[model samples]
Target: MFRFLRGLVLPEAACDEANNSSRYENLFKKLDVNEDGRVDIAELHAGLKALGIPLGKDAEETIFKTGDSNKDGQLDFEEFMQYLKDHEKKMKLAFKSLDKNNDGKIEASEIVQSLKILGINISEQQAEKILKSIDADGTMSVDWNEWRDHFLFNPATDIEEIIRYWKHSTVLDIGDSLTIPDEFTEEEKKSGQWWRQLLSGGVAGAVSRTGTAPLDRLKVMMQVHSSKSNKMNISSGLKQMVKEGGVRSLWRGNGVNVIKIAPETAIKFWAYEQYKKIFANEDGKIGTVERFVSGSLAGATAQTSIYPMEVLKTRLAVGKTGQYSGMFDCAKKIFKREGLKAFYKGYVPNILGIIPYAGIDLAVYEALKTAWLDHYASDSANPGVFVLLGCGTVSSTCGQLASYPLALIRTRMQAQALLEGAPQLNMVGLFQRIIANEGILGLYRGIGPNFMKVLPAVSISYVVYEKMKQNLGLA
Candidate 1:
């Protein structure tokens, strides 16, 4: 009976050692250029460079000298193994340095001080969060055993391995419905590669928006002219668009829509990261309210910066074939005719929608994630991919529902200039007129298409985003 139970339980410690050994062997082979069974200083330097590790000549020479035992100039396999063992010893010594009081346990304050020495400016709250993540025994601090167990099996010899380790171990709070990987090494942050985050986010946004472009254009059409004599439903909307400008018209304005994603995502992600630093509590943990405020402000920032493009997208989506040529032509005509203010026609309603959409999306996602973890997971393991997708779809739907009326009003305002004999209305005036003319249901004219696209759009965005990050070696 005991032997049967033993078979059921995995030998995690042994497996971890085997994984580390395999990684070491692969790295050694990579460094041994020409299969010469030895790694010279040049080979080591070349291998490190290939892995994107920035090392000066002096640093490379020093590393080679340290690894080359017995006064030899090259590292044989046994010498390479010894070098790794020495590295492990050095890491343990670094951990011991954090235990300033010689208590064999490292506290939050100690971690903070240690990182400060390495030029990492983190708050005490952040230190506590890091400690909590690794404090497996609920001790609130890492003992020697815990420290050794966590770090010994993850020896990173190059920048790529360090990045991989960081990605696997750290949890980032990006204040979005998606659970994106957001950890960056100190060097990466200092080098101003924050643009990588922007690139990944932009790609994700473009993919999601393009995948749902037809539904999006339909939504715009319905919002602007659904109550007019045309009486547009989804099928009639598609047919009318095709009849007007061919099937390609369904994707009109998509160029501007996709182009704005890079700047918008960059601004939003950068602003949210800055706001997180500002809102972190004494324990470095941001509460739900703080997260909501930050996310809303970030969305507003992105929207404001890209509002002109949004105006162009809306106009192109609803314009006739001869109305304007393309995005630049549309921009030139709008500027020549209506001036800069036309670009911000729907500014108020667009900003207003951000609060409800982001708030509801984040609140629902967190609540569902928490409930699932409580009921299903054993020890705070990450929820499955399908679970995350379900949560994202439900939360996104709720957010869309909460904010659809304002979105409709915004779309109408954006297209108001194109309609002959249409009266310009403020956000409140537009809301009142829509309700009075078309009834409450009128505000949700194209919501069927909107709802139909939300699930697949979000799922594809998240999956593609993760894969892109992995390909870029950021995840």
Candidate 2:
């Protein structure tokens, strides 16, 4: 009974010998209302109606011609079964003949060959469609697994139905119809600390740039292909940068990064809040996990959107010292030198880092805020100062720790043109070389100063953003 019920729910397929005949036999036995080898015209009509197949003009004649092999004006189970078996056999033969290699696999080239043999010479446009239908991976090659998944009907697979359901799920919250949650009252959701946030994050970034600039310069110098150092230690690398470019060259792109970060954080924080609201529960209440998840996703989205600028900034920093005047000049020079795509160099490393960096950073930020509010300012109406300090320290540390290795790879890839000339490192090759030459520790070379930079940078950023939010009352 369960098997029959399951079959009923399954989509209709081309009728086959045993199954079709068995189905018709069951209907014949029901409609005949008496034990008989044949079904009358009236009985046939009733059976067709029951099966949801319409019997219209010349229906009786058609039935006799199709099902009644003996011209007996009615179908017997044996005759019907014979017709079904013949039809099914033809389809199976066609499929087998197309499998030219007889490897039970169908590649694109084989499919094209089969089609030509059958005298259905597909046009280029038509060929593309045929390829797409069978090529599940979009690789332009149809393997046996792909053929079976797409072409062959299997009782176990409902791939199309599952995909359809996935497509239909979750409408985005858009327009005026989408209401903002009111968990924190309008008054309670006060403005952010714009100026304070700005100064703190900005100062931290400036200081970080100053502190780490020499190390960054050294790292870039060591990555230089022409540099004959088969082995470059940090000490030796630093000596090289200082000797070649002078001490001032270490802080080369500090101004550009400082300018970029303020607006970067602005977009990041704003987009994060908006995305949070979107992914958050319809209920006003959101848990720590949800907030963390939302914040991380938001951070990733923001980082991706702004990464081109980061590429430009890094290029300006590590390239020929004093060659580029500022961000705009660097942008222009990069475009002229390597094309616009160069600005998005190291996108893989940049994007991959976002997942873990954002996840850990935002999770820590929120956790710190909650802890501070609970322990330090339990009775305070506004947990502003405590939240800002906690968020700054936690977020920056998490982000730097999670992202610095990828950061190293990105730096190398970005400077490859200037440093190595022509050749560049794909993400895999760069990491492989890093591990091979310097060991795993090589990837985290500048991590010390990076951690130092993040504290003030993130702290000031959040403090400014929160102040702005408080002042604006955007909620």
Number of the top TM-score candidate: 1
- For lDDT, the strongest prediction is 1
lDDT of 1 by residue, 357-465 (tens): 8778767876776577556654323556677767767877888889889888888999998999999889989889988988899888888878877766776677777
Model 1 stretches with alpha carbons more than 4 Å out: 1-147, 155-194, 228-230, 277-288
TM-scores of all predicted structures: 0.68, 0.48
> How close to the true structure is residue 207 of candidate 1, measured as C-alpha lDDT?
82
lDDT of 2 by residue, 284-358 (tens): 434445655665665566567777777766776666657887788888888888898887788788767766666
Minimum summed lDDT over a 10-residue window in model 1 is located at 2-11
Error of 2 at 321 (Å): 2.9
Q: Clashing residue pairs, candidate 1?
A: 125-283, 125-284
- Each model's lDDT comes to 0.70, 0.53
TM-score of 1: 0.68
